[model samples]
Target: MERIASVDEIPTKGVLFDYKEGPFDEQGILVRTRDGFKAFKNECRHLPMRLDDREPADIWDPHGRYLVCNSHGARYRPDDGLCVSGPCEGSHLKELPVVVKGDEVYLETDKIGGFFNV
Candidate 1:
């Protein structure tokens, strides 16, 4: 696992990750919830485009109840990364494992991202 960012750095809404390993690049989103934190690849189920196509902070729905895709108005629940409405309904966002230690957050690059597998 590699420390990606501080827990404090993540906003209450969410944040985008430009995760890269050698030539492998994947966009991700991290959302902090009352239970803890949830992370998922930024790709939407209906398309190859990112959910945060406009901006990371803009992913939230109008009422801030879910993560809204700017392209097709898809809404994903922050707690479970599930699409509740839109073209991708019934599909799930690809979840990534995360660990929170003290004030820092680390991505399980090996189990999920293959960051330093050599």
Candidate 2:
């Protein structure tokens, strides 16, 4: 994992940001969870499409509970990237470990896996 952006770089709330994990890393978003901060791969489990591929790159609802993929309106939990609705109901968003050091945010590339790699 390497430092990419800071908390300020990401929107205060209900905002999504695209982050890099490594050379072969997948695109992800840094979210502000009620417990703290978390990240999830932008790719959707239903297909190889990135959630942000839809018109709105960031589709977090006002309540900020889950991220909605604009492509097919799929909703996923930010905490663990679990799907709650849409075609991929039984699937989950690939979770990426993220660490916030001081004011900088780092994505943990070593543990990247789940729906995609499988």
Candidate 3:
């Protein structure tokens, strides 16, 4: 497990974190919802590209209800990483396992083997 962030560090806009998958460096997004904290790969379902590829850190829609892929306008649910609209509708974002321990969030790197095809 790798410590990613503290619970208090996650904002309404969410937090972007970096981790390693084998020798490759990858990014994940950590979000806090009504249910609890959720984490997902920064890649969009429609394509193997970062959701904020076009606009740095501009991952959320104007209303902040959904996470928007700036390149393709795909909107994903913050709580479940489900693409509800746009080209990737019916698809879900690749989720990264995360556990909150004593106010710190840890990425379950062991569970991520081969998931990212890296």
Candidate 4:
């Protein structure tokens, strides 16, 4: 496991983090939701691109209830990473395993295998 951020570091807009998946450098998104903390790869299911690729730091829609893919207008649920609208509808974001310990958030690197195994 690798420490990513503190619980307080995650804001309503969420936080972006960097991690290593095998030999590749990847990014992750950590959001604090009503159910607790959720983390996912900073990627859009419709394409091999970051959701905020077109708009830096602008990953949320006007209402802030869903995570929007700036490049394609895909909206995803922060709690489950499900794309509910736009081109990627019916698709889900790649979820990353995270654990909260005390006041810090940790990325379960061991659980980050599968497609990221490389």
Give per-model TM-scores: 0.86, 0.73, 0.90, 0.91
Q: For residues 55-82, what per-residue lDDT tens digits would candidate 3 score against the true structure?
A: 6558988898999999979999998999
lDDT of 3 at 16: 89
Q: How well does candidate 4 score on lDDT at residue 74?
A: 90
**Native-referenced Cα lDDT, model 2:** 0.70
List per-candidate RMSD values in Å: 3.3, 5.0, 3.3, 3.3
Error of 3 at 63 (Å): 1.0
Quote model 3's TM-score. 0.90
lDDT of 4 at 57: 59
Model 1 local distance difference test score: 0.80
Candidates ranked by TM-score: 4, 3, 1, 2
Q: Which of candidates 1 and 3 reaches a greater TM-score?
A: 3
The order of the candidates by lDDT, greatest first, is: 4, 3, 1, 2
Cα lDDT of model 1 by residue, 2-24, tens digit:
77678778878777776754467
The residue-by-residue lDDT of candidate 4 on 24-115, one tens digit each, is 78888899889889998999999989988895558988988999998879999999999999998999999999899999988888887522
Tell how far residue 52 is off in model 3, in angstroms. Answer: 0.7
- Model 1 residue 116 distance off true place after TM-score fit, in angstroms: 9.8
* Pairs of residues at least 3 apart in sequence or in different chains that clash in candidate 3: none
